[model samples]
Target: MKKNILSALLVMAFGFANAQGTGSRFGIKAGVNFPNTSSDFHENENLIGYQVGIFSEIKTDERFGIQPELIYSTHKVENKFIKEGIAYNNDVKLSYLNLPILAKYFVTQGLSVQAGPQIGFLMKAEENGINITDHVKTIDLGLSFGLGYNFLQDCSVDLRYNLGLSNPIDFHVGDENYKIKNSLFSLVLGYKL
Candidate 1:
């Protein structure tokens, strides 16, 4: 399964590279993430994480473009729970391979706004030092909205929010069902070639 995914990415890279001749560009990005989740649980806290990615921007005109990115993102959430009369903390770390395809609208020379759909494949999940991969769903569906600024022709910075639409957790409490969805804010720097 991993080999298939790697093959697909290679094919996409080649296709995007060929598209550069028709007003497209490739870029590399790295960023910091502030991640959290919405859940039925009472006590939760966010932790700082990180992401790295590659993207291709295909320009249709001076004012409009399409940007597709493949990113490896990590998120950590601290869950506080009470066990028998004691309170304890479990730090959950989740990693994903995220794919986002955004439509960009240039409002000014260097400024743009983008919105898009994103899909994330879970790569790893852990609580403390133990693996808890099976406790959460493997696929995440989300939306992304952001503002970007391009400077010095080749350098850019972006601020984005990713909102997860689907619950990653599935469980029942007595006769009630509970859900949990992940979300995050990202600040990233990019260089285009």
Candidate 2:
């Protein structure tokens, strides 16, 4: 958690340093998220989530830019487990503070491709009718890829996928090692300021 916060600060510092003599735009963004988890005990199932944030785009050239975002995101997981020929359904909800550093390449006048790495810190977690606060891990690392269309110079829409690279749960229940993976897909509406 501390590491993720420090990394986000460093990135923001770098962005600020590079802001001199560059065209920059700040924007507000809101998005819907589809979240899932992967593990041995349960298969992935899509759950609805959302994100709201602010971002800045610093253009280095006509074809390339750097975008940094600070966002509040919700993530959920739903799965069915089978043990001893019986099935049980479980649901998990997690709230996160997410920061993403994106590199964008303009493919056309109004279209672009963006990819980046995102770091997330867990703010809250709930599972199976219980508050599993201590059982949840705080740090999350992921990669993001997206396609965007700039309808106007200051307005755009994006569809993005976030693939988790680390497990956010320490599932240790009497010598059982069951971990949950965090992944999400999002569609965002953005407007520059």
Candidate 3:
């Protein structure tokens, strides 16, 4: 399944790369992520993470366009709690290769709204400096919606929220289940090339 997903992503990327027509542009982006998790086990505190990526925008017309990005992103969360008079602090960080293909609509010049599906392949998972990759799922599914502002002819800023649809945790104890999902908000700056 992982191989299939990787193949599909490659094909899609190549197809976009070959679309160097009149209204297409390519760019690089870097972002900060405010990462958190939804969980039944414990409350998670958001932590700062980061992402760097490449993107392509293909304008189909004056008002609409398609934008696809391949990014390396990190998500982090910290939890502190006391159980049975014992204090515990835990931090978890997960890294992924993320692909987001967005549909963009320009509401006005330099202002656009974007919505898309994102697929993330997990690269690493660590808890308090220990590798915990085996305990988590390897793929994540999400939806992204955001606003983008283009300025200075070749620069852009994007603010987006990623809503996670699948639980990344893979642990269950008999009839008990733990529900956990990852979510984050990103503030990104882009430069067209």
Candidate 4:
């Protein structure tokens, strides 16, 4: 099953590679992320993260395009809570290989709006200095909304927000069950070659 999926992805990549000669651009991108987790049981610590990736933008017309990206990303959320007048902090750090396929609609020559579905494969998970990979789901589903601006000299910038659609936790804190969902905002700079 994995081999079949890999084969299909290779075919799609080859097709896109062929199309790149005609107005498509490929580039490298890196950025900072503000990662968050939503849970009523804890106070937000708001961890900062990082992402680096490759992207391909295929133009369909002067004002429309499709952009696909593969990114290595890190997400961390820390919570400090007071129970029985004692304060404790718990932090969860996660790593993922994220794929986002975006549809771009240009409002002007250099500016476009983008929206996409993002699939994330969990690479690692840790909570409070302990490995917690076995407790979290390996696949994360998300939606991304963002804006992009292309400049001269094959440079561009993107600002995006990713909202998680799945609850990633499989355990509880004391007696509290968590429905933790991911939220991230990112700003990336890209240069095409």
Q: lDDT of each structure?
A: 0.86, 0.83, 0.86, 0.84
- C-alpha lDDT of residue 60 in model 4: 90
The residue-by-residue lDDT of candidate 4 on 1-193, one tens digit each, is 2453365357448756976788788889999998857876558887899999888888899988888888889978887777667787888999987888899999998999999998887778999989998888888889999999989869999999999999877556577666788889999999998
lDDT of 2 at 165: 94
For model 2, name the residue pairs that clash: none
Candidate 1 lDDT over 1-193, as tens digits, reads 3764575488558759877899788999999998858877668898899999998878889999988889999989887755456676778889998888899999999799999999888889887969988888888999999999999999999999999999977666456565778899999999998
Q: Which ten contiguous residues of candidate 3 have the minimum total lDDT?
A: 170-179
Q: Once model 2 is optimally superposed onto the true structure by TM-score, how far is the C-alpha of residue 41 displaced, in angstroms?
A: 3.0
lDDT of 2 by residue, 119-159 (tens): 88888888876887677778889999999898967899999
The C-alpha TM-scores of every prediction are 0.90, 0.87, 0.90, 0.89
lDDT (tens digit, per residue) of candidate 3 on 73-192: 998888665555667677889999888899999999999999999989888999899999988888899999999999999999999999999999755545557667888899999999
lDDT of 2: 0.83
Of 2 and 4, the candidate ahead on lDDT is 4
